[model samples]
Target: MIWETLVEPFAAYGFMRRALVGCIAVSLGATPIGVFLLLRRMSLTGDAMAHAILPGAAVGYLIAGLSLTAMTVGGLIAGMAVALFSGFVSRVTPLREDASLAAFYLISLAAGVLIVSIRGSNVDLMHVLFGTVLALDDAALILLCVVASITVIAVALLFRPLVLECADPQFLRTVSGLSAVTHFTFLALAVLNLVGGFHAFGTLMIVGIMILPAAAARFWSVSVGGMIVVAAHIAVSASVAGLLFSYHHSLPSGPAIILAAGVAYALSLVIGPVGGLARQIPSRPRTQL
Candidate 1:
């Protein structure tokens, strides 16, 4: 049966199991961080950080081979560098955050491509760009789990301050001693999560996976915490559906996964009860006397 072809391989292959696990792990780490980034209006920074990881990953592959540990370490380093540099530029110059982020992405992408081309040979640039989840190894799965766990814990501990600062930085400054330092620290952790998911989801699709679910959740909830929970659920559901579809249909996993999220986003945009397209449409006013 066609269904058996889809279900059987996942049961038969450990790689498939690992791939599924990795997707779940990425969802856990990325979804909450995505919500915060969206609130901060730093969504583009997340995208840049995702692309910035490529050069580090390529360097890691060149030096230590294609091991997951090497690539992850490289990615983390590169992501942090980009995030820090962006922050520094924003603080020191008149350029805005989005402009700086745009510059960072282009430079990082060009650097990554140049490095990969020079190092050359067996590297699959497309894989780095789009990801291939079915090829995940046990080691990569474990790394994903570890990174997800850390991210969850970090977010949970900082939830209150982060939320307060995100919604009203000036209010937090007036009430508490929250500084730019704390803001930078939170951004750093977000960059880490984005980089952590890069290998599994790729630069091209990471922004969609990170932001779309959170954006969708915003339509369904008024409370920030509630939105985060909803976003996580949305992300997990999309990942599972995409994984299944890819398994059955022989499609690339990243695009399938992003497409699934995109559908959710579109649905939320149109039919979501609150602040959705339906609600945003100005009701026809009765003619006033």
Candidate 2:
């Protein structure tokens, strides 16, 4: 009974299969980035950039009327521009990076809403805000797969520098001048994944895939590689659970996935052994003196 209830929906429906694949692909790309974001203390930056991509997509909606290519291109352009410009502002001005990103996040979200209102109805708006995961077409699914492939390769190539860049920026600068390169590269990859998944998962909930799984994993492991592995598993589990929940309850798909991730995080907070409520500080047993 349990197996049939869980596997039947996906086996019977092609859309369910596509949604599952899309969620998995996005999770693979988003997990490592989320780990890095958490390590760098930039968890909310993912949220900020998620909102920051809206204006660009809204512009595409304004001009092309829900054309996927148009909206995607617009989102890529806008997300990259905001990311780079905010980094520039932080370097050149007194405002910190978080402050600059937060400012642009608010502005971009408001502008995106207004622009969407100009051309799209509430229905269109909801699609952009929450996404239609169960209704992913071939183009969007293909895009997610491609983004996942590119992200895996790029992350593998950038691994060493990114680790150094995240763990110790000053030492990285002195040893190798790839600090700026790695930072911007990281931002680009992040924006790429978000933009790629925006049409399928929407901007608001996509970050949940990136951050929540990584957050849950932090309580499961200490090594970066271990956390990444655990995070990927968490992401896949959340996607599966979320799809099942939506299927059974007739709820919105995207939010259901995020909510499932939220549940995982809540569970991790309570029972995870690394840093969870179960063990606030991991301590080794005292050796005999």
Which candidate number has the best TM-score? Answer: 2
Predicted structure 1: clash tally: 0
Candidate 1's C-alpha runs over 4 A off are 1-9, 282-289
Write one digit per residue (lDDT tens) for candidate 2, span 235-280.
Answer: 9999999999999989888988999999999999888878797675
C-alpha positional error of residue 55 in candidate 1 after TM-score superposition, expressed in Å: 1.7
lDDT by residue (12-104, candidate 1, tens digit) is 878778787888898888898899989988888888888888888878877876667787788888988887888889999999978888988
Candidate 2 is scored at a TM of 0.95
RMSD to truth, every model: 2.4, 2.4
**What C-alpha lDDT does candidate 1 achieve relative to the native structure?**
0.81
TM-score for each candidate, following the candidate numbering? 0.91, 0.95
lDDT, residue 31, model 2: 93
